[model samples]
Target chain A: MIPTPDLSHLKASDYETVYEPAEDTFILLDALESDSDTLKQLRPRLCLEIGSGSGCVSTFLGSILGSSEALFLCTDINPHACSCSVATGLQNKIPLNLVNASLADPLLWRLQNAVDIIIFNPPYVPTVADEAWTAQADRGIGGAWAGGKDGMEITNVFLPHVSALLAPGGHFYLVAVTQNNIVAMQQRMKDIYGLESQVVLRRRAGGEHLSVIRFSKTLAVKTAVFHSNTSNNEVL
Target chain B: MVRLITHNLLACHAKGCTSNNFPLQFKDVQIVVRESEFNPDFLRGFIPKIEWPALVSSSRELGDTSLSDQLPEMLDDAFLKTLHRVLFEIHVEEGVMICPNCSHHYPISNGIPNMASSVTLLIRGLPYLASSWLNMKLANDLKIS
Candidate 1:
């Protein structure tokens, strides 16, 4: 197994400002590690991590795929998290491009339908909707977990962007909780966006059931659907 | 520092300023060059996704003339190495990314770009919170808040 990226450089003070790698973060890492072979095979050129708090996830991805030529782009609202992410990338010898932007807003048109891999471990804790709005505005540590209103408020804002941002055959990995209505989300992606998804990894972590849902647009599924339609026509 | 890879994906996000916003023009850039281990295979995979004109012009703006205006068709090791350096090695430590259209400035200091805008998006998103509250109100009427 590929060892986790070196985050020893981040101190407690850093955590006070930035998000410390937690169970949710590890689960994301585990899911990525579990898919190492597939990721290597994909040979992704551009990898983006929205809300890259400690940079652990992107660094781990760099380590898995080998930070040779693929660009590792990270965005965080928290300036401290941005700094910590850059520091972590430097520590791990992964040259991460840190953008202190909210939800890849600055990159929308420039990266339209072009990103090969996207991951977001958004704020997913249920809180008052006002709290989530305030936390997001604050752009601080609170922004990491104050997910307001079934914890889908922040993640929901980003959902539409997923289908718009991904390239053909590109994959998006999102870390969500039961409160976010995982099944409903999967259905919505399939129904509205034509994006196929599955629960890549899930585990009960304390009160929160964390799951990493990997969504993608692949030609194989389309081919299967086409074949099924052709067979129905033949039968008719 | 902003690398060409990042530059290639960044556009000015000033409100109501969309077209010609891409390839943000660099001004007063402080660049730092650092060597990263080269993997030819990754470069080969990456070339297709990049906006070649943007990458070339942006790299030249950062004072690296390693590449030509046009990307080469042949995938030679020498060409790939130069492409790799232009894309990954040169970094913009301190600068202002001026929007070509709106002329808004995004500052980069200490290797991190501040993409925060004049008007914060979350503030505009307050209506979303109000909508969420309305949903909660309905849920509460059904005794499900």
Candidate 2:
């Protein structure tokens, strides 16, 4: 069991501005740890994490990879989060490149089909649409949650860019709640982008049913089909 | 903060600022070279994915000329070491990244780049917010009547 990245450098004041790692973050870590072998086999060169609130997730990924080979790029709307992320990376001996931008707005064209791994733990709380917009505009701790209209207003905007950004064999892991209509989302990604998905890990945290869904190109999984089919022929 | 590896992936995203947006021009930059663990295998595997010309030019912009103008046919340790220094060792502690196309400046201070166009976006969103608030008020008034 790889220990969680040490965030001893951060203070209570830091949590006021940045998100403190919680159940959702832990579940994402568990999912990645479970898939560590596959990830290491991929030998990813570039990994991006959108909304790296406390920088815990990306730092954890660096630990899992256990090498400095891959470039870990993290983005957040909050400037404070960006600073905290950089500090966390330094604390954990992970080299993280931080961009204080909303989503992947500045990276899309240059990184087209080149990102090997993409992780996003978006704001998945059901709030009024305006609240989400305001949170995003404010670019503060509220932006970490306050997802508008079934907690998908922010996630929906980012979904269309996933296929465009992922490398041929790239994997995108997303955190979503039951209210986000996970089934429909999976179907939409498969239908629109030709990406296949699997529910990697799920847990009931408080009143929220949080799950991590891993999406990859349909063609990229052909090699793994034989192994997967041994357990469930329909998976292919 | 900026590194050549991250800089190699940045392009301008200002509204309608598309062509020639990449390889953001650095201005008034302060650079620091911090030693990092070097792995030759990682550099070798990553060479194919790099935009050679951009990396070379960006390195030159920051006053480093270790890399040749073009990618070398050889994959020797000496070359990989140079590539590692250019890609990972050098860090931009402070700078303004100017978009070649739009001339929008993204400032990097204390090792974090502020790339959000929040002020303009919020200004643009105000009218929509006001209209929605008005509609809600009108609906509530009708219910009262």
Candidate 3:
């Protein structure tokens, strides 16, 4: 197993503002690890991660895909998270390009249909809408977990853009809790954007039923016809 | 720190500010070149995906003239090395990325670029407040400037 990126440089004080990696982060890492073979086969040139709190996931990804093989671009709403991400990349010997932007705002247009891999571990804890709003505005550690109204307020805004941002045959990974209605989300993506999803990994962490769902654009008729059974049977 | 590879993917995201916003102009950029292991295969694969003109112009703005205005018809080791240096080796330690259309300034300090706007700060929570407040602030800031 690939070891987690060394985060020895960060301190407790840093966690006060930046999110400290937790179970959600680890689950995402595990999901990526399980899919490393497919990811390496894709030969991705660009990988974008949204809300890269501690930069652990992207750094881990760098190890999986050789450090120099793909350009790792990360975006974080919190400025402190952005700084910590840069430091973590440095510590792990991966050149992570960080943008202090909210939810890939500055990158959407330029990266149209170009990004090969997209990962978002958004704030998925159910909370009052107002609290989520405040957390997002605060742009601090709170923004890492306060998911307003079923924990999908933030994730909802980004869903429509996934199909636009992902290149054909690209993969997108999303982390969600049971409260987020995993099955419904997968259906919506397939219906609206023609992207098929499979729950790659799931675990009951504390009170949360965490899931890592991988989505990819549905291929043309010939390929889709052949893979239909395999994809349908992949529901786990 | 921000690098050209990252910068190449960035466009201005200010609300209602869209056209001619790409290839953010660099101002007072403090760049450092750190040598990295060269991988020819990766560079070769990435060449077709690059916006050649943007890469060339942005590199020139950062004071590297190794790449010509035109993408070379042939891909050779020497050219790949130059491409590798301009794309990965050079780092923008400090700079201000200005939007050509809106003139929005995205500052890079200690190697990280702050691309968040006032609208983005509040849009997630208070969309109504963000729009009204953003308009007022933009008007006030524009007047002041």
DockQ of each: 0.43, 0.44, 0.31
TM-score of each candidate?
0.90, 0.92, 0.90
lDDT of 1 at B107: 91
Writing each residue's lDDT as its tens digit, candidate 2 over A52-122 gives 99999999999999649798999999999999999999899988899999888788767777788999999
- Scoring model 3 with DockQ, what do you get? 0.31
lDDT by residue (B1-145, candidate 1, tens digit) is 6888788888777666657887999999998998878889888877776899988888888878888888888989999889878877888899999989889889998978898642465654576667877987898899953
The clash tally of candidate 2 reads: 2
- Poorest 10 consecutive residues by lDDT, candidate 3 chain A: A227-236
Q: What is candidate 3's fraction of native contacts? A: 0.61
Residue B60's lDDT within candidate 3 is 91
lDDT of 3 at B50: 85
Residue A72 Cα positional deviation in candidate 3, in Å, after optimal superposition: 0.3
True contacts kept of 1: 0.60
- Alpha-carbon deviation at B143 in model 3, angstroms: 46
Best candidate according to lDDT: 2
lDDT of 3: 0.85
The fraction of correct interface contacts reproduced by each prediction comes to: 0.60, 0.60, 0.61
In model 3, state the lDDT of residue A118.
98
Stretches of candidate 3 above 4 Å error? Answer: A219-236, B127-145
